[model samples]
Target: MNYSKLLFLFLICVLQSCTSQTKINGVSFVAAGIPVTDKHVNPVVQVNANYATVMPFGFIKDLKHPEIIHNTDRQWFGESREGVKQYANSLEAKGIRIMIKPQIWVWRGEFTGYIKMETEDDWKKLEATYSSFILEYADLAQEINADIFCIGTELEQFVANRPEYWNALILEIKKIYKGKLTYAANWDEFKRTPFWSQLDYIGVDAYFPVSDSKTPTVEECLLGWEVHKPIIKEVSDKHKKPILFTEYGYRSVDYAGKEPWKSERSMNIVNLEAQNNTTKALFETFWKEDWFAGGFIWKWFIEHDTVGGENDSQFTPQNKPVEMIIKSHFEEQK
Candidate 1:
């Protein structure tokens, strides 16, 4: 090849390589957001990059379930903490800043078999439960040197009535925990939430249905994102704050035409398919949106029997196709 042609090709390759890579603290990050290469410059160095939240690092443990809590306390606590530590270690080792999300919520049954806070007493109990949970989780985050911490997840009814309580909670948390703080409000209620001013960033659990049908095509689902974009922009504009999707996912099962919302029915074929399709649609649409900082799937894992149910199945993220899709997506984003 001619000398000019060879040099032109070399320049093109260098540009492409640079475009596809980001380096922090000497560690190389690929497009997918995950660090593919790292050198031990110092873990704390990477913790400074201004990136969206770094997670799927967070999960909910049913404190009401003795067995679940026991297992988590005995094995998962250290293991999960260490796993996050390694993640932070890798990213920070490269000088990348990560936001850690540790969410506390009352499980489906723990709050009178519903996701809402129905009464004043219910709100009080939930507030207390969350307060204690945050204390424990905050300590864990500190141990792992997490960069940010979410104090609560979607408990809208409670938040609406107890705005002062949340302000108080944030104050108390600040006294103990030293990192960015936020609460994950449901997408519909995020605007009505009175506590956004107290948080470092507005965190939301945005799983608005992109399509009404059980099995919408990927293109149809992506189109639905158009509907949500304005809502996201409005929130960001009004609040004048960056947003994060703290919990977001769809079931892979089809609940289109089944009794008792078939997708919630255990061992029911209709529900299983609906769940799967919903899962597929969610991933397709999420990647298309640019307003979001980033979000964690509804969950990481759940107990075996805890899979089927109305709100339950939608929140469980373990062993699903969505998980693999996320891993691939983030890898590419890196």
Candidate 2:
């Protein structure tokens, strides 16, 4: 009567329903210049993304400078701190877990990873200024009861060089924000940081290259992940901390899988299939791992509604096929 087969099928259905809601299904809400509208919030909730990460930027002119280049007195330049607190409140009202991730926007430099100070005095000044920037957000995160607070994002070399400074800063942040904390490290730089034990989760930006092929299938992308997963699990095990892919996504462009970490806009190629494939590969590969805490996909925007459709290519998977894949994956956890 094939009772064994029937039992297996029934168990599959039960498992599917059991994992339908995620522990931390998340997406990065691009709240920089955009207003947090119901239109945007609705879609994010629709995707079943319960976790929302909002980034506010603080700038720096050079590594040696003591001043952090932010215009608003106690707020980030473009996205004011008041604005972010409001957004976090709104997101929480809709039953979303929030992460306030403050990123460094280098004024005349390539990226934050390039920030390195030669002298201890310079490093101390940099730490002092950066600490002020982080503490402001920490106060807000505590005020709003944010689910997670990332102390810094992608200040790779600077953090690697001054572990003592970062450890002290984490201690200070702990004094303010009571929520879980993490630092978003570049994929290649997570292993180099010595302060993983100080934070709640090991946050990796997860832009690791999947495949070089312009049109790799979902299977090929999974193959790439297979190589990376063991290394990630090893780190998580060593640190006794679960890992979170703080930012992970693919641009809807040909060969986006080749260098998933590159933030630069490539040629005007809109390969929706490629983006979808990447989405499937990542979620299917990582979602069920015990040490894998879940991820926040690269971005979702509140403005430029027409920018990320079938004919356009960008990381915002808002109006594209990739979104459905995200929704389905997130839904599976419900």
Candidate 3:
């Protein structure tokens, strides 16, 4: 071969190698009262998603409350023990991996991060109850042979104030569930999480604030990521673990990336382009990086065809312009 041709081939190979991504394209399947069926699983498969996070919730009255109530009448059928197994089996049969994520829902939509006890007695009580809540699901995760088991989700104060407790909890959980483990730290809380070293992957619910633009452009959001990418990378490097976005997505609304964490329920204009661009920027920034493992989009409903449309500006990409953008990225294997 000529020297010029050899050099051109070398450059092409380098470009492809740089762009390759080991992404675990995933969606957080929202729990429903009705059972999960092939109808529901088909959409996920169509997206070329290989992983799905199935969350069953336990509730608490407030941040200071010690008791975590679970498996009650108020819970949805899909969040129940029987529902989770069926969902796992159905999805796994179609060659999708499952991540059983047990999360705590504070009553009235209070933040789970602020859960702190006023007294040592109350703390102990909370510990015992929280442990029970997690362990019960841990056993369920093992039974289903889940690919990943998320021990907790966005409980920042609980982890910070009780490192020893979290350490012990990890040990206890390992004894029961022999699967990959992670804790879903809030986007901002993952840095201080003391136990990332003990787990398989450093999981973050990556709702990073990428831009303040009312209708942010993809290039603008990429600049926004330039700020957070290094800081998040620091954590991954320190612990020598890949970073998995346990939850990450933007709503199809104005200022979607300004505070990516907010649930915009009040009347807001739907900007399908804004959601598409912001989500595109995320894939551009993290997917190709070797240190960043992959992430699950914030939510996807069971009623796939009926869910989010042009008129709606929720986190879900369903039936929106962003859906196509996400699908294109997911379909691109590695």
Global lDDT of each candidate:
0.52, 0.83, 0.91
Write down the lDDT that model 2 would get.
0.83
Q: Against the hidden reference, what TM-scores do the models get?
A: 0.59, 0.89, 0.93
Q: What TM-score, to 2 decimals, does candidate 1 have?
A: 0.59
Clashing pairs for model 3 are: none
**Cα lDDT tens digits for candidate 2, 115-181:** 8877788878887788888999999899999989999888888877887888888999999999999
Per-candidate total of colliding backbone pairs: 34, 7, 0
Per-residue accuracy of model 1 over 1-334 as CA lDDT, tens digit each: 8999999999999989865533111111111222323432231122222332333222234432211121143333323444445555555555455555543323443431224455667667666755665666566556656667777666665566677888888888887778777777776777787877777667776667666665566656667677876777787778777677766555545533122122244633334445555555555654444444555554432122334344434434334444444445555455
Instruction: Candidate 3: list runs displaced more than 4 Å.
Output: 1-21
**Candidate whose lDDT is highest:** 3
Error of 1 at 226 (Å): 2.0
* Predicted model with the maximum TM-score: 3
The stretch of ten residues in a row with the least summed lDDT in candidate 2 is: 69-78
